[model samples]
Target: MTGPGRGTTADTPVVVAARRTPIGTAGGALRAVTVDALAAPVLAALAGTLGGPVDDVLLGNVFGPGGNPARVAALAAGLGDDVPGMTVDRQCASGLAAILTAAAGIRAGDGAGYLAGGAESPSTTPTRTWADGTVYTRAPFAPTGDPDPDMGPAADDVAVRAGLSRRRLDAFAARSHARAVDAQRSGRFDDELVPVGAVLTDERPRDRFTPERLARFRPAFTPGGVHTAANSCGVNDGAAAVALVPEWRRRELGVPGLALVSAATRGCPPADLGLGAVPALAALRDRPRSPDAVEFTEAFAGQALACLDAAGIDGHRVSPDGGAIALGHPWGASGAVLVVRLFHRLVVQGRGETGIAALSSGGGLGVATSWRVVR
Candidate 1:
């Protein structure tokens, strides 16, 4: 698929505006909200700002209502039927995939503007009864007969293989919470968060974090395993959206944007999927320069540490405003949420010029997308 070069130019696809709903813990503030309901508000906020009508809408979702979520969000947002919509599901990487798809459309000369992102409502996820009168929840994380191990156990496997100690994982989790709380106190998240009702901020960041508190939890997946609930992401609900337009349109609209540079997706074995981000970053190693900032989703502290270590990325350069470990992981929405964070930091706050967002997904998928502030 076509994509932008590293340099900013009139032909490049630029992200004009990005916003997200406050991430809510499962069964928390957003439990009653539907995926479309959560997404429509963010979409409407972007539509209110774009100078021209949107050409299309693409959204990523996992475990949402079966109908076309993008179309539902568009209609609910009052965008006309002329705005075609599509929904994609690449599990946790779905959000970044949707963004990449929109960028590809601009490169292919298919359209001038698009709305894209991802949303999830884990609290509202459906439960199903199997053919043999057994109840099942969640689709298989891997292909049938392909050894579909759950992510927590897979994370434990990654820790064991990488020699990540339990103490190290606990330390990472504590740091994530502390950073998130600091960012919150400093108003770092004020600009990008579009309120969902009275819920004004992320629900998962712990204000009084202590390593001892993390150590009190038992292993969630295995006997004497490193992965505890404290070090893993919580099921969450939220939505995020971005307005993408050609660089020329951005200029005409008199709006600032982040220029799309490159993106790649790779896969690994499902049982060791947390390391998926390692190969994704390797593909982008030859870029014009190292990314000034990186957002690697914190699926589990051990796996995140392993991926960052393998990539040789220092902890200081990753997730400055905290990550999924503190903010909660809303599956489909987490990837796009990373982009929103990058835009806020690089473009809005002038923290850096270039940034990368990377995520590891269930079923052994990894996705990475790079962006540069429009000059």
Candidate 2:
């Protein structure tokens, strides 16, 4: 499915390296770690995997503590001072945007190869002081319109417009948790999730997830709304990194079975829009028929479903292993996280159909990438 001169073929794009920080709920140990420390371990792991220095490091970050994120992460990860880097900011889609940028660079022969990935600590968010003296972090960036509204209001409006019932929404959320529990039990995520050692103040490192405890928290965005704290994604801390190597150079480093497939980027109207995933889906599903399956990060269960419906695909075809609702959505990291999850699913499922990963960002933007299973 890969075209010639596209830096890919029918072979798997070699994943030279892969690593991630343990995902913690907001205000967790990762909050204790600096952004540089937050991103360094994963990059270091990637460098060690490739056996040498890489050409560039692409990072996806929504809220950095302060200072230049890409440079800080690169330096903290032990890259040379001269090594180039770029920080991507496309809202939630920033991670996938970063991946596309790095992939394009390698495909264009800009450098020997490159690293593309994302990191986020939504826990340590940057707050803004409004004239009313209300401190907020994510409100200013959520959807807005004539009356103006935050993401929650926009989501409520989306639900109303889509005719999504509370019953249906609850079912969707329940399904996500069930699937995640199953995937974890079946070892589907073991291949990707990295466990990090940490100290909680003066205490020892302990597991962060406890289903019983997680079930106790109430809704975050809309307290009385259908999206509960248990169901809705929260501020989280985690980092993921991947290496992209051109097909021709696969043998030089003894890495094989990897390639950059096809990708598409597009813009949509900015508003409390009803459908954000249409343009990107239309572009990637350009070949013959609808995509075999749609893999989207669960920014919100209903909103994610809206995109699938807009694309004219069954919602069931999306996120078979659960989504942000269960795995947690860390804003900028969700885009690349979707790609990484899709890649793993394609590799393990032994299916031949192409997969599409699409995400909607703030400011009416949608981006998608297509990956053909390398057999």
Candidate 3:
């Protein structure tokens, strides 16, 4: 487990070039596309720019294909026959875990060289069936009954325990929309997105939001569910890919946005697993000059606040442009999506230097990752 700051006898890993599809709501443009299909163009874009096959392909898919999705996406995107793939599931933290694994592969001098990024999709998501004739929903937010309480109900539970009020949730949703609008208007996302050819039957690239648009949606979970469409992470479709430089060749192909800071992934108690980020707080609290230095991108408004409060993060610095609440969530790719968004905000704009993407997931589990932009 040799990692950053261990005097680990090598340079920390860095991102060479990274790009993602503009996220869109399900049944939208990419709705008909396969989870791997959405990712193909993104992989092609990165490869075309980088001029070769990547070191590997790592995917973060929670509910789609059950067998070797990472490898499938790798082959689908023209990554070449030799490149291997690893599919990881960390609830929502899957994408960052993939990124870190790729980074570690490079730092380990294992000759892994470069890695491609990925996340989940639900529109064409893989569905499961039982002999009893019951169907299981696989879309990002597909609501399937659970013998155990689920993330939505769990959010209600967290709300009751944390005493989060309806007013706060509404306000947070509003701010998320406003900030997402700001991000789009200011073109904060221009650099992060790749122009995957127009999704068939679609005209726009990324999901668009506004405070007013969210204000009209009603509650979702319960008859009077505390969570509303605007207040929750929208069911969305998208893909992301980033290249990692091999330690042996970092200097020769030094890309403009190269950066290596630190990252960690942790687990949370299952019963209240949606509250996973609790551990990430202590992991990053003592960071250098990291004061007033906290930023987080989470999948849900209720849990993001609850987890941050649970982790004792400084509230002011969290997802300045709003998160899933505004940007929408594509499940499997969520962890990586949040970190890339944070990295771009920090590296591209002049946002906080240190940021954390932490959140809980469906099962009694959660994870977090840390990142610092290359200066």
Best by TM-score: 1
TM-score rank order: 1, 3, 2
Per-residue lDDT of 1-375 in model 3, one digit per residue for the tens?
222222222456766567777787887767677777777776766665443446677777777677777787778878789978888876566776677778777777664456656666777776687668789643233234533566676676776688887667767767766766777787778887866567422122234444455556776776666677667777778777676664324344543344455555555545564676676555653343443234454455677778877776655566776567767777777766665676576655656555666666665555565555443
Better TM-score candidate (1, 3) = 1
Q: What is the per-residue lDDT of model 2 for residues 1-375, given as tens digits with 9 covering 90 to 100?
A: 223223344232444445556566778666666655667777776775554558898888888765767778888878779777788888788888888888777656677556777888766666767899987555444334434455665566666677776556656666766777677667777766655555311111123334444445554566455455554566677777777665545555654232445667777655654245668777863432555555687666667767777777777767777777776777767787776676666654544356777877776678877765433
Worst ten in a row by lDDT for model 3:
1-10
TM-scores, all models, native as reference? 0.95, 0.82, 0.84
Give each model's whole-structure lDDT. 0.87, 0.65, 0.64
Most lDDT-accurate candidate: 1
Pairs clashing within candidate 3: 55-114, 119-333, 120-333, 270-364
TM-score of 1: 0.95
- Weakest ten-residue segment in model 2 by summed lDDT: 199-208
The alpha-carbon RMSD values of the candidates against the true structure, listed in the order shown, are 2.7, 4.9, 4.6
